[model samples]
Target: MNKWLTIVLCIGLPLAVGGVSAYVTVQNIQNWYPGLAKPFFNPPNTVFGPVWTALYILMGVSFYLLLREPSSEKKKQAILLFFIQLVLNFWWSILFFRFHWIGIAFIDIVLLWLFIILMIRQFYRVSGKAANLQWPYLAWVSFANVLNAAIWYLNH
Candidate 1:
């Protein structure tokens, strides 16, 4: 693949998936979401859009770094972990915002967090920069897990 094409895919794929989740998310944000009991730690609603967009871009960049690795075996494992986490990330929005399944969303986020940690470890073996890029994602998802748990507990 050409370098530009690789970069585009690296960044575009995650953003596209995020865009899908956001489509489902916006539908409920005003109606279903506002009605739920939220945790005290919940950031203002405005914060989520920009933050998540940034995270997705970071995820894509990390994947690009992993993809650029010379070892196909290492790339394969990291790519697999990356996609697993990305799918989990996508489903959290759907499960929580679209279906209003708070408990399931919490579980999904936890799994996503774990996958991200594993991806970081795998990526570290391929590219330290890729591993480092995932740290903020790990941190954010860790925070999101706590937030998801608190919301589930509070609203249940």
Candidate 2:
């Protein structure tokens, strides 16, 4: 396969998933989300789209770099961890925005954060650059966890 095509496919996977998640999020933003009690530190709705897009792109690049490594048990583990976290990532929008399950969403984000940590560790074993690429993602998710917690607290 062409290297460029491979890169696009890798990046597209996350972006495509993000698109679906964004769809779920958009559905709520106009009707449901505006009603929620958010933290003072919460960013405007405009901020989320660009932030998430950049993070997903970075995540795709990290996964692409990880995929360049030779197949090994560690690589396989890292791949599994990536997918697990991605699924968790998708579920967060549903839990928080669609279902309005803020408390459960907080729990999901915590588990997602842990899985991202494990994924980054495994990515390091495969490719340092790949692991490095995930830092911003981890940071954003960390902030998201705090935001989720605060929203839960404020509402409940």
Q: Judged by lDDT, which candidate is best?
A: 2
- Candidate 1, residue 100: lDDT: 92
C-alpha positional error of residue 59 in candidate 1 after TM-score superposition, expressed in Å = 0.9
Clashing pairs in 1: none
Kindly report which residue stretches of model 2 are placed more than 4 angstroms away from their true locations once superposed: none
Write candidate 2's Cα lDDT for 82-123 as tens digits.
999999999999889989999999999999999999999999
The C-alpha TM-scores of every prediction are: 0.97, 0.98
State the lDDT of candidate 1 residue by residue for 1-156, as single tens digits.
Answer: 899999998999999999998987897987888888888789999998899899989988888888878977877898899989999999999999999999999989999999999999999888999999999989999999999898899999
Candidate 2 residue pairs that clash: none
Which lDDT values do the candidates have, in the order given?
Answer: 0.90, 0.94
lDDT of 2: 0.94
